[model samples]
Target chain A: MISKKKVIAVGAIALAAVLTVSGCTSRTDSSSGGSTAAAGAGDAKITVAFVPKLQGIPYFEAMNAGGKKAAEELGITWLYQGPTTADAAAQADIVRSYIQQNVSALIVAPNDPDSMAPLLKEAADKGIKVLTADTDAPDSVREVFVNQASVEGIGEALTDQLMTAMGGKGKYAIVSCGETAANLNAWIAVQKAYTASKYPDATLVNVVYAGEDQAAATSMATDLMNANPDLTGLVGECTSSAPGVAQAVKDAGKTGTVFTDGLGTPQSMAPYLKDGSSSASILWDVQNLGYLAAWAGDQLATGKTLAATNDVNADLKGIAYDSSSKVLLLGDPLVITKDNVDTFSY
Target chain B: MTLDERTKPAPQSGRPAGSSTATAKRILPLPVTGQEFVLIGVLIVLWILLGIFTPAFLTPNSIQPLLVSVAPIALIGVGMTFIIITAGIDVSVGGAIMLCAVIVAKTMVSVDIPLIGAVALAIVVGLVLGVVNGVLIAYGRVAAIIITFGTANIFQFLALRVFGSSTVNGIPSTLEVFGRGEAGRTLGVPNSFAIMIVIAAVAWWYLRHASGGRHLFAIGGNANAARLVGIKVQPRLLVAYALTGALVGLGACFILASGTATLDQSVGSGKELQVIAAVVIGGTSILGGRGSVIGTVLGAILVQTVTSGVTQLGWPSQLANLFVGIFIIIAVGTDLLRERARRKA
Candidate 1:
């Protein structure tokens, strides 16, 4: 048995030694781990982190690849972290951790904008730059939003493709991913408005929510076709649902008669396009959108204020910045048909 | 706790001392219990109604996919039935499925192995995970739910670490034989569903005729009494969980085949609840002692039917949960009433 006083003294000495060693290591780590460069006035590598709603999907994975290329070109470190599932609370937790790490800048495509606003505010208050990409948060929540295209642009493009397939007038329904997803809701609202104004003969009959499950979305699409005999078109509001709806249309053996299009990846929509189950899909240059987002994050990190006519990147020419809404436009949506779908792969 | 101190009522009058099968004298007209009969009747009614309302509901294109989706859940429910019968639960199987799926998926992507080898690899991995859970719970003397909940997070971390990226893409057509396409079916029946039926039938047999199976019910009914009679309680408990893990591995293969070429990390999210729901809705008691794998298979079919029926009817898909909740209440509520009546008798 050991004496209690001697044990206490020895334990105290060991604790002191451990603490001194840890304290010295932490000091050196902080000094050398880019904080000094981040704090310096010039010639420092900006570390910008991008958080997606969820990782492992083709879309976000493509975005990360593009962001990595941009980071390499711009001489910055691009850290990617996100939840495995699309849970708003998980996204908020990741954002909070990033805030604690005190990165130079953060580019987030938030799962829930309202819930993430406070965390974004904290990151901003800590002098770390904040920006939104692919999907915008509220105007006040981000420094600048790098939007692929305006909601109206995408909505009109999709509706136009559907109308053309329907011979300019027909009954159609919208199959959306989530009922309350901010980006999906915004695009749906614009698509409905566009259909009402542009094509009076084409009617938007119903809007179904599938909650991002492929099977659920496919079933909903088939049910829509079954319930509405005269239905001639479908607009998939998200990437995953687009292929699902197309598969449903093919399963129902209404390939040529019923046309489908939406915001989708080239790979998912390729077979459908080739088989004439879907006429076309509307999307922007995802690679460019990611590149522009990383460039913006780097710009904000390096203490440069974004204003109109800033000429952010040499490669992406003629890009305009909106000061009031803090949105950077990435230009018009491109249409991928059977002839051109082969060229694009996410 | 003593026999009287257990939370739930002990073995009722209708049940034999060490058996749940209706071999003892009973006043009820049929040997089969009310829950199983009620489930069959409800399922028949639901199917008839769905067919009448939606002409497309009875088609092979729709029914085949529905059955394909039902296969994995029911297969796992067989083992879950065994676990729930012994008054233990394994919530970590979902995470276990994830780890198995990514491992199998990555292996298939990297190396061209035979189908049997792929399946064996998945099952072995699952067995190891299940044995870990069994040893911790049975030997450590911890509560099954609490220990499983902790293991669930740990297993998820392992799966995520294996899934360094977001999704595994460009997977080959090696798993197409078990997929929903033309190759996955034989004689107009999905191979996965057929395999599930075969496994469930074997489980139903073993539970009815095997002494090891009867021992599980004995342990569930009264562990102290069973121990006094010289039954090894701890090893039996371990077998139940290890069996569940093995089934989860096979079921993960079914899931891998069910989807497209891309396998995502959300492969097994919330599956543990699905399996539990199937087991309980099949009239299996969560507290312990009473259940059947046959009822569990039927319960899985019933749950899938509701989901497919709701979608085919053009009704709100979310309304299926409301119907499932009602079914759970009715199934378990009547079982509770029956248990109380038997105790009073």
Candidate 2:
């Protein structure tokens, strides 16, 4: 009995020792994996990985679809993943895994730009080409930013479209997602300034944050309308809240009375646009934007500098790339009304 | 405690049991509890203040939508109050709602199911999830939070897999009868909120007057002691969790109705926190000895009021979170103090 017990103890120790040795080796191996790949053969497929703010949402999925298409056309491996929620730490984990996998190029639409700077630097140091797409990490060591539309582009479009519906507007409020989202805040800033400059009669009454919640956006839009009885317009500032604001107007039995235009996907905004609750959805072609990001990542990976004007494809022609600031510009934001909503499925 | 000792009225009843022949005289508690009274008072003060500040706040347009928003949370809170009463918590309702909403939304679009059929499907799916949670926690002897937290992630993954990486668009508005639209109202009251009130009333009575209800209190107070006295602890816990799942299914339908025509992956995001916040603020003890469904109903109303009031008053929407957090702390603080005082006495 004592001999059997000793054998069991010895076996357990052997197993623990074996596991400890293997774990240490794998740890060192992964750390060195990135460096070796950066210096290794050119025969392998050029891998481009893009991580969005969140996965499974229509906006990002369309981007993923575009990225996949670009991968097929360019003959490179396109790896796409993101945190299920637009959470920074979770995004960072996925980014780190991609970095370890030694993907040739890494792209991120960071949820938190400030926190992502160091991680981007770490990837850069490992010799992996790094870039930002959709949402930029301005202070990071990224080589390029694949921008879909300028802050002025979306903001002016939203304001202009809603003003047209409101007949140059009376009072408007903005329902935005993510209180601290950099891009949304920039757009809101532009909306505030543009509304003030362009339309003398239109007033920006309030801007509320709904934190990527469609239902909260709807309820808040209702409250905004109630708060300002004469309020004629609302801008749903994110994909989720875009339809949300329109739903609020419809539910309140004030469809034509209150005009809403937001950054909504076409399919989601189709119902509202047809019903006349929402005037227009101002957004760039999301899938095309994704395709551009993957293409840019490959360009950076291959050490090919983008020209001032480059033809990407038939759908994406004469795309502008600013060499000094490293920003790749996808042209004007597309406005989706009832007439054009069905044309773009994503 | 012996069977003789256990047969006596629970301390929560606030009176000795079997002391008189008249069953009316042995009524467990007053129709309302102290926490509920306080909640009612706070709600009144806030409403009056909101009415004064925002002239349109008291109108049907504003109030009707507010009630519509509160319906789902309170409806789910009824089941949550039951689970908390049995010393259990289900934080997976958010994920459960996501799965149920997506499934129902997909079903409604593809199968063109009617309102009754849609609702029934959601409830059954939710019940199955609840049973999965209940069976693992109740019989497996795992902590409720640990099990529910793990299941929450699992449910989210399943929901995401079902989504297949796209939003469920063009959802038919057949469920609009429970929405905030014109069809969702009856005689000036929102149909969804009215239904929630009826359900809450039934729950309030059951928790206060039923034998099964008292057994839940006993089990929560001490599961082993209750088991010794012949209360089926595991089954009781199972029933509590399963009941919550069923309510979550219905709540998801209300949520879908209240939302836009498109259903996205974010459909039920952060909803568990909202429902849990409402339940705790409604004066249900987190530790699980004493609570009321009325308090939960009122609590949901109060939370929604604060959210709507903050927006109507043109205050930064983040202030609503701060106010709800303060309310939860105060409710739990007061509960702890009361518990301490009771023990000392």
Candidate 3:
């Protein structure tokens, strides 16, 4: 017969071993199932993942927080995850991983339009609703792009701003982040055409790339300032470039002479706007962009077909879908100057 | 020590002590050979070929930018060589670079610290991080690879927490100039390249002639034997890691100085792999005990050439990475073959 003490010892050892293995397995299982259950709840629950070109940017993080607010209000599950870096391969891996987890819908701001096509196509094939927001993968099979503004609208606005700032006749320059960035390039092309047609007297002097890096943007801005001392106005096409350009102008003490404006956050551009270093900055409500993305995701996930006249019920009422382009355009962008700077939060 | 006596052939008569010493020193004057020589030669040939094919390849304007672009990466590769030589690795270098850069940028921008103070603080952060890794490996008795892999995530999280999601700009112009400004021209040559040459030469001198350097090799060759010889293995290992960390910290500052440190989650992502590839291709044995700093410099140049060349050729950027992957495999394969031959001989 086994002694009672030996039997108790064996029992304790067996219990510890089982608990240890179970603890490991359960940790993995619970983490995996947590999001799944969150996605599966009631009719109120809509799962939407905002896949930015990459993760961990203030702009994207702000947008994700905005999206989260909408999710909380609508009782939806919002998953915000993307590649840590802005590389096509990493983005592709994220797409595959999210698909395996079977997210109800996906909204991506693609890094490379063509490189991400196959993966986006795979998501489409899986009956998962995919939308492109912020940046488009035009060649990809993604449906219903949520545009902050029309490409032509952004182009026309940027050109008009430059023309007015330059008094409709002066040599000016543009600082862009990348040549291949579809949205920025589109705006540049439109501005170029506009400069030729509308303001023939206003010459387009030079265009430089800063690679979406702020330091590079600052350097390029400084270079432009040094290269064209008589340049009247500057347009920065990326968020990071805009603030850097504004700061460079301010530091160079050419604020009044060289009018500056572009896409920038209020927090970054506020000082420049107030100090008259920058004339204006154009931006949309990043938070509202997130809200609309979730609403669109819900519409597609619920078998509701998108139409031009269809009003998708959103936290902010009346989100219209343009069936012609399968695109949902957000409200107009605000041109934040000293007058209106206080009105916007982000 | 007389040159004439040193040059004289050992007499057919049995040689005395002086001749025997000379023979021993001459036997392996160059410790590296075979695959290492071939790898360096190949890289040199490619540089010449690219210069011929690309019109702007040899121009100061084109090449200066390439050198600037490769500087930060080359610095990291230098540190990685030491880690790899010790029969261990640290994949956390990229994250460590990011963390150090963020710390420096934050200190400069928010704390309003002077440039010197910020740089010193960044180096200290890197050194502390290296100590953490060393302690975990030496005392905790964990695998260096596993410890570093985990530490990468920790460093990334720390960076994000401190810097937030916005790119830090408006770095002091003085710092920027150091990274971007052309060093003083000597005979019309760029000063940055000259600085790199100096760094390479010093590293070579230390690795070749220093007693501490020999101890590093001995420990790498066999830890047990090194301990038996009372070499104080753990402290040396710690020092090697700390040195690498300090170098990486300097590299990060250069990168930030090159451009504004964007709160990019991917700031140093995938860079550790490239550094590892460079060290491996430099004829460094992955399992430890042997590496040359000059070979590492060549490796960095080769990697940089491929990246710039492919882009200039208008090929897809993906092809650049693919070529690196291929080169790494071929490099390691050749090293293995050479080792096999040496053992047989």
Interface RMSD of each: 8.5, 7.1, 10.5
Q: What clash pairs does model 3 have?
A: A58-B165, A215-B260
| Every candidate's TM-score, chain A alone | 0.85, 0.87, 0.84
Residues B1-345 of candidate 3 have per-residue lDDT tens digits of 221232223232234543667655422225444455666678678768767765555655445545655666667777777777777788889889889988787677666677677668877998888888888866675557767866776797799777666656444543553354443235544444455667667766776777677777777777779889988878878877887788778777766655532334445666788788888988788867878776777777788777666644434445667888888888787666655654665
lDDT, candidate 1, at A345: 66
Count the clashes in each prediction: 2, 0, 2
lDDT string for model 1 (B31-61, tens) is 3445677678888998888878886777787
DockQ list for all candidates: 0.23, 0.46, 0.11
True contacts kept of each: 0.13, 0.83, 0.16
Q: Against the unseen true structure, what C-alpha lDDT does each candidate score?
A: 0.78, 0.88, 0.70
Tens digit of lDDT per residue, candidate 1, span A13-131?
A: 65566445433433343334344334532445677888888876777888888898898998888777666667676667667766766788899998878778888999999988999
Give each model a TM-score.
0.82, 0.91, 0.67
Model 2 local distance difference test score: 0.88
Model 3: CA > 4 A from native: A1-55, A68-145, A150-285, A294-320, A331-346, B1-28, B31-55, B182-199, B261-263, B312-316
Error of 3 at B51 (Å): 4.6
